[model samples]
Target: MTARTDGGAAAEPSSGTGRSSSVRRTGRWQGVAAVALLAVAIGVLAKRPPLLLVGAVAGAYTAYPRLTATSDPDLSVRREIDPASPADGERVSVRTTITNEGDAPIADVRIVDGVPAMLSVSDGSPRCATSLLPGGEATISYELRARPGRHVFQPVTALCRDASGSVEVETSIAAASAFECEAAVPDVPLRAPSGHHPGPLVTDEGGEGLEFHSVEEYQRGDPASRIDWRRYARTGELTSMTFRTERLAEVVVCVDARPESYRAADATEPHAVALAADAAGRIGDALFDANHRVGLAGFGRRVCVLPTRGGRDHAGRFHRRLATDPAFGLNPPEPARAAEREGGGAPPRSVTGDGRNGDGADADGTVSIDAQLSRIRAEIGADTQVVLISPLCDDEASRIAQRFESGGTAVTVVSPDVTTAETAGGRLARLERSHRLSGLRNAGVPVVDWTPDQPLGAAMTAIGGRSR
Candidate 1:
């Protein structure tokens, strides 16, 4: 059975087709009755038979709308997608065929296929308008470029109007449509220290690894491969080479879904919260591939925390939650606020014992960062590093990062560049964002300044070099 996704509960298919229909009055012919009355009055006052005929014609037109009967439009929608499992950044072509199953002819019909929000249309249109007779069909084709993550198509909307255009039957056609694309590991460098696990993170402690750390006098049972043969030959004594110890790390990929991070550089682009959520999924996948324990969290009006775990199953569940969970869904927490820095010139709030800044909330309903951080600390291990994805649009976001770092939690801030310079306010916000990032870096926190236009891997690589 085809699945329904209309921002509500799935509709059960009836008559072997998933369709739900509703009717509404368009009010297109409401003023025609008044015109007919006026014409009849003119004919009576002027005593002209021609005016009377005009009144009769107006009356007929007015009655035509009321006389026209439109049945519930029964539509069967079938969607065909080319290259069903598309690679990231691959263009996908979709064709939707809509068939009218009702006995009455639909004079005017409009159909709009559901397109996933994360996938942008690269070519063609998903909408079509035409007339459909009994058993007649219409088709619409569109192309969308795929991105990382699983995307589900919403239900198609079809509007059928009667011949008089006075009534409209709106139908939502459901079809099974969804695709999952795995994202490549970003290979983001971790400046934070690692947990005690054998993996790829290099540490100062000498152990098994390719990169040399130091050499010491050879001890009994030292691996022959690690023995410094040249040093032994020169000094007539044995020495052993010690390479940097590589251990895996437990990482929590946290996204800032607060209302302030919902800003987008332009209307066409996804908001910062959406971009951050996507980045968090990629980072979490990377850590998981390296056999490191990965946890997920979102800090905002509603905080969502998943405890640290390592495995393919955990990664799959983590990625799916990021895509479908209400806390991390594409929808913003609140209306997009102006991308201005936080108001009230005050030093960043320190981590208080009670996990509240003064009273835990402000008069404006803004929750204290300390409370949120406290929740995170309670769930994570002491060695767990936090990969914070935020827009850094407001000072409070920076404060959250700094607080996490100061509280002895390893924190890496990934700030997506969502500030545009199209207006004076945008320019000022961009300047302020720059200073905030710089301040975070100076405070000894590793910061990745990411622009949505650039590949995330490239940004991570750049920041990795800088941190090294």
Candidate 2:
């Protein structure tokens, strides 16, 4: 059978090709009545026993369907998904078994298992048409490609019909399983720091390296090669040469998964929330490679936070959180208060605590800006530099940047410009977004206004080439 992807469960099923041939009130009873009456009249007038019998049969056939029509169908369905939480672009198999619990035999049975709207079925079909007797069962299996996000399977739609095709029972039942794709955390390339910490990054600082930084009085345990032999010979004093320091910094990749930030000029294109995730992962990977301790945080369904740490294991933990975590895998923003009124909506709230500050986030993902800032200030370390990925539509990013700078922590605003100036409203929105970026720069926070047309690495490189 050809597998199909439905946009989602429909309020009414007759809208698509999976249409049912429901019973119609076309007055077929009138035709049956006319035939029965004609036969009865002929039998009485002509005194024919054959005509009388024919009339009786006609009457019984017409009434039998209505009498046997089933108003209530007794049935149960159980669904299962293998590898319920699959990675992005992975395929998953779904199976559903429906059992007939009624006493009578159902001649025609049609079932449609609710599928995730974001997934596309690659093999088999969720729908099946079959007949089942009392205690009999039927099963359906299908395969679907997994997308990045949490998906809630809808209820099952079942239609049962009697043998005469005259009676049918239609009802929906809850499914046994749900599918989810967690946040896919990735590595990101972050700026290096100067410290005597164990890391792969080679920076311009006085520590251990080949490049000379400065010379100081020789200390114990100094390698002979590090000693400035010419200076020692000339001055008859032991002196050591300091080289660049290879160190790691506490880097946090902050993603603005806010519903308002997830938009695009074209509906067909992926939203900015998705882009931010991609950048976060790749950048985190690069930073980790350089031995930088990478962390992750975001504002979506809730505040998601991971502390700064460095290791291969830590990288895997970050990816798992980004891919499967509800805070990162939520759907795009709906047309709600969260999108329209973001300042009062969810801000940069930390995820570790009670969603603290008493400004609880709404179910749709909006939090108070002050509460978010307070949470950030408390949750993150003082030495950590925040790499913020957002659309910069609201003043939230600017405010956060200002606060971080005031606290002596460097902040970079990498905004994915998703606005189009094709219309008056579009032009106005673009102007406002640019203004927000300008304000951040004025506040000493370097901003990278990135457009979606180019790769994220290029935009980041542009920001990196400048002195901070």
Candidate 3:
């Protein structure tokens, strides 16, 4: 949470006393001069009364009000943001209400609402300028370019000045409020699976997966078709068919949220790590809706690994994890010797650890990319498909994809390529990006090169089509 206080002016008693003393001293001197002039004028007025009148005018000017003005603008602002689920690049409206609870009327009131770094102002402005009377209320509305994850709002400022203009005061509203707007994940409808588990799992009843595994003596309410005619003929008794138990596929989505991979090429932009997390959430939701088990794992500075489970509760868990995870830079760990052995294109040497180095042994230090992929593969069944979401910035990610393929687990990569040829800084950066793209393609990994400048779904579809 971020807070700031500004714009209240306090009058020092010593300073005020000193100023009053000076004024009093000057007034006494002027009074003495006026008395002297008045005495001289009284003597001269014996001959002329006009001079005595001038002395009285001067004395009246000295006795006029010596007014000192000071204003204190005490403002309090509270904001409540709603509709916490907004999609990437989507427009979200933020409503801010300002109340003047102070005694002074605030003039030239300008407010700056703190927006999330990931969000951009694509349409309306976040700053507002207005005037508020005491006990009056003002409302401001603006649109923000929503990005995935939680964002905090900053405090509102109030500027007020006194009527005399001699004193000016700026005050920040106390009791500031904050609300989080979670960006929604984009999802594509999933195709229904062919099999099911019979005990409490959702499925299309009477399907091919429901096979008759046993038969028992027929009882009341048994369907005629379920009756075993052969058993009835042999034993002269009616029997009912029992179906086999059905089970749904359990899916676990493991996302790479390490600091190195989290940062975008343009540091000002939304991090790729957040994008990958959004995609994972979308996929997880789709699977959950289909009655398939879904799980989430975020590997970064602090690993947030969740166990695989099914139902609406699990989906909520996954969403919460994705919304609060911290963003990391795009550096991945070094590749293993096995990655080199199973060759495709030469891996780039630019990739390195995110400041903190990982030990060669998986248990001794942080889990390397290879070990994580292996662990994920081992946890799921052979038929389970592992959807790896990453920016593909390093050799380790490619190696993991290859390992998953070789391990008989179907691997589909959703690569969010933050690199752009239009503004790659220099020729060297552009060349490096080209080489990385080539290497990823050579590995036969289904790569989705998503750019911040374009729509993610369209880019992924284009890549998916070309791969086919």
Candidate 4:
């Protein structure tokens, strides 16, 4: 943001505080010198004592005029910034103005504008030093580097001091301005063929794709390349060939933001749950823009699902919700000792009601893990593609994925591996991690091992390749 000063000329001080202070100090010192000189003159000239006293008094009075010198200046400051939404690593210009608001003439004025922490000044400082009389103003300008996310403007500090620096007043003015630097996401073409699916579902509506659908009698609007020469030669009827519709796919991005997924392997912005949310947002946008139906779902203690929809509006809604979602680790299973490792054995038949195993059943004879998966599978249609986003640290998650895949659902695992040494230990821990991953992959589930250090688009590209 830039700064500037406005107005011109100095104004007289209504209050004499500045003049009074100067007079008081100068008069006292002059009075002392006069008394000493009067005594010396009386000694030197007993006959000229009257004349010496008059000279001493005259000298003291001369100091009074000097005390009357004072300057009362009125000063104000303003700042401005341009192109608030700058891309990361780009430069933005800042402008400022300083104005004389009071009657007194400010000998020296210094103004400083506060900059958000994310941005760094690239050229010149936000601070400006100058002199301004009442009604006089000055303008200052500079530049800064912008970073990603929202950045707020800080208050501007102004220091007004006299030429002698004996008297000074500090004032701060509020500036309600900010700049946003947004990061860029890679735009990859969506490959799904069904235009009905949410997102940028690519279609054969005059776009790139490979599929033949029908042929119609050629009209004036028909493209030359679409003219079916074989039909024209056989029956002497000109025809235009139409291709099959090829659009983006419908993708349901399910994020496990339950308290269980918040654990992180390292300190990073958007911990485990947040990372998953961000990745989901980026992938959802790409798919939606490619003309696919995209839906958002968050599962934890409670499940929040945004019905599948296609369009830019839906994409924005998903992002806003994800940004504000709660941040907490998933709840541990009740009766910690009863926590069953995923894929170790079938969960108790009572909890799941599948009659698969007896050991892991809950008190009510319910298979807790599989039951949840069953509900999820029921909610989504058999043909719909499900992308499960989570930091799969336990066996239940693996089992859930396995069940979904086994139930004829195409499952793509976006695993935000958040476990660190502090949570998992030794060879046993490593083996368990490997086992759970293997179980899902073996079930024909495409897995994306996403970490916090990499961009989420990278993971999606890898998954897209596998899907193709």
Candidate 5:
């Protein structure tokens, strides 16, 4: 795996030049003035010239802090992560350089590079402390154990102090950097598929297949090998053996990227949406490898639907869309109005059941979850199955799974277990999640209860075993 350093389409840097309005007193010399006054009083009463000299020195020290004023330091930051694209559990090295752009020397410069919350520093430090003269730079180096997802860097935080250390200024520098790790999924965990095109899935319909379906009266153009020769000899009748029909399946991998799905058991770990996206990518790739038509969708702030298709190019498009689409973004979707107010991209248009243009939004322009489900239902065909990836943190996720299954579409749910027992609320949520998964299973929906602690393959194996 190689990391791409080009500031191209993949690297989406944060907006904003830099923010440095904060300035405050450090109070390093808070009591020095009082000490100076005490020394001066003692010198005047005791009538000692050496004491007076000492007092003068103390007074100068007291004034020294006030002599240098603290202002926001002009600085620039450059960051780079090597082995940008890493394999699962690979360690990536990051280096950041903070340069002082101001003419004056900064006596104390402290920098903290913005590391993605999902990644943890495994080696070295993301922090650096040094004095930077004009045009000087300091580097902060660190190693991160890469996880699956598109992890983006936040703004770099810098703190500058004056020579006396009495005043400090803090600022944030924007730098856009990110990397993605794609999980290797050997096969898509799917139940028996019902599809149209000829492929691996066997259907009840008799056609060309390996599995026996039935035997019927022999007709013209019947293949000689298919004839029931033994039965024909015994009964003076000819019959042709028919086998089950095999067909390729179209699968839509839907990711639950709603705000509710962003929950994580640990703050430092990747959220459920990220995990879902990662799993969805792997599932899509596996389906494509099997010659099955694959599509992508996101039930986020707006309904996103990429109609089912097949090809090597389509696979690449699917992976790129999962990584870059706002619906599957690492951050929760901003409210539609808020996004408009902030001049961000407008919310995507709601899609109809036919995957065409439709207004599924309310007056506030927020697409309802029901509308999103309706759109997905429209995409489902007789031979198409839906693989729903969600955290299952709430009843809505269960509702989605049940809805798809009730519609007569083969549905398999891959739920990332993000619930923890660290708190009372977390414990309750965990219980609720357990109940929800159980309910889904009872409802005849295949549920893969996936915990981040185990590899996705293990969870798929559990699902595969249950599917049998």
Candidate 6:
């Protein structure tokens, strides 16, 4: 019923007592002895043969514990999980094997595999019980479903028992099984500013800048400070001065975080959505640092938008939204809220009617296909450049990218290839993905083909920032 500390006894050397680790009495011995004594007393009073036989068995069973030595059994445990780095919702098979390495025979051994907390046993159990002799090995196999993030499988719980149920020795076994589920997002690629929305690019035809552009005929209301007074004194003609325009690009970094995007090539790899999300944050950070106004828009079962702004604080806010925006995170919308987001009468979880506000349909859940495109257009205004980060798993991404470009908004597609050619279906899927990207390129959308494992900058550098 309760565990008592062994104090000095636990620390004592095993050689003197012919025992190993300190053991605990399971307390079942006391209950068995009481029952045995009662049966024997009843048998003696009634002189019944059946009762006497039952009492004899009970008494022998009671003696079994006393006959066995209370010592820790010598055992070694090893655990292995196939496909260690499982993607979200993927299943991984795990096997835990324990060996009786010592000469003593273990009557009963229970071994429990340490499954990660973020993972659930989808197919088999985490524990198994068995008996083993010297050199005998018992293996337990199970399957677990993975989620996002890294999870370390805790140490295995091993319990050893002797012939008698009185003594128990407990220990833990750790075989270094760590399962990391999320995809790696190391760097993001960005197109240097050209002619966009106004950050740092100096335009030729400009006015009101620090650097001198050119002198022009002075108008009646020209500012005296801007007038070329030296030229006027030399040639006696009043002329105004002009300077280059620092035009910054209005940029919208779009990330695809749909449930479909949360897929990995197999159980032992990261998912596409994780990669996309990481890239989105990095790109947003870079653009913000470059003094370009950057906004974030997430497309999934729900749409999330954070208005465009240029500052370190806005970068932090973008990172936070990427971390906690429920539309793109593990937690789905609550029921009432989900209803409001999805209901027609309620607002769509799409971009707000006024995209510049950056408060898109205010957590509107998933919208219809047309509504999605409409929201995307609304989120990106005219002359704004859009960088879409996706895995290109579906053709719809290609179509959307092209649609934006055709609508006078320059669209750049940065797709991280997540498909593998391991199987026929995977090969076909990869080919289809290539075709879709090719179609986008043909449609004049600059496609930045990238692999998730590689540095994003390398891929962009290969293209030398040329999107069209």
Per-candidate TM-score against the hidden true structure? 0.73, 0.54, 0.49, 0.46, 0.69, 0.49
TM-score of 3: 0.49
Which lDDT tens digits does candidate 4 get at residues 1-468?
123332112211121111101111213344555665676577567776666667666665545445434454444455566765777667888776767877767777766665553345788777778888777877777887765456555445566666544344554444446666674563433333333432334344542245566777788987888889988999999998886555556667777655456544542223456566656766776667665677776666445566667778988887766654332112233332144324432121111111122344334544343444556666765456677887777776776667666776666788876656555363454467677777777766777876545555576677665232
Candidate 3 residues lying further than 4 Å off, grouped into runs, are 1-77, 80-114, 123-142, 146-249, 265-267, 325-378, 426-438, 452-455, 460-468
Please tell me which model should have the higher TM-score, number 1 or number 6.
1
88 Cα displacement, candidate 2 (Å)? 16
Please say which candidate is ahead in TM-score: 3 or 5: 5
The local distance difference test score of each candidate is 0.75, 0.66, 0.53, 0.57, 0.75, 0.65
Off by over 4 Å in 6: 1-198, 201-246, 330-365, 464-468
300-326: candidate 1 lDDT, tens digit per residue = 765678988889999888987787554
Task: Put down candidate 6 lDDT per residue, 62-120, tens digits, no spaces.
Answer: 78887888455666555566676667667877776777777878888776665653345
Number of backbone collisions per candidate: 0, 23, 18, 63, 3, 11
Q: Better model by lDDT, 2 or 6? A: 2
Candidate 5 colliding pairs, count? 3
Candidate 6 minimal-lDDT segment of 10 residues = 9-18
Off by over 4 Å in 1: 1-70, 148-150, 160-171, 180-182, 205-208, 215-241, 260-269, 332-373, 418-436, 466-468
Q: How much does candidate 1 score in TM-score?
A: 0.73
Best of the candidates, TM-score:
1
- Residues 1-468, candidate 3, lDDT per residue (tens digit)? 112232212111111100000001113234545674775578585866666666666665454422423334445444544444656566777666666766766654555554443455666665676777887877776777765555544334343433323233433333223334443443422212322443223233332236545666678987887888888889888888866445565556767765457445543354567567656766676667766776666565445556667778878987877665432323333333234325532222122112234335332455665555555565666555566777766666666667766776555677776665567363454466457666756865555666655555566566544221
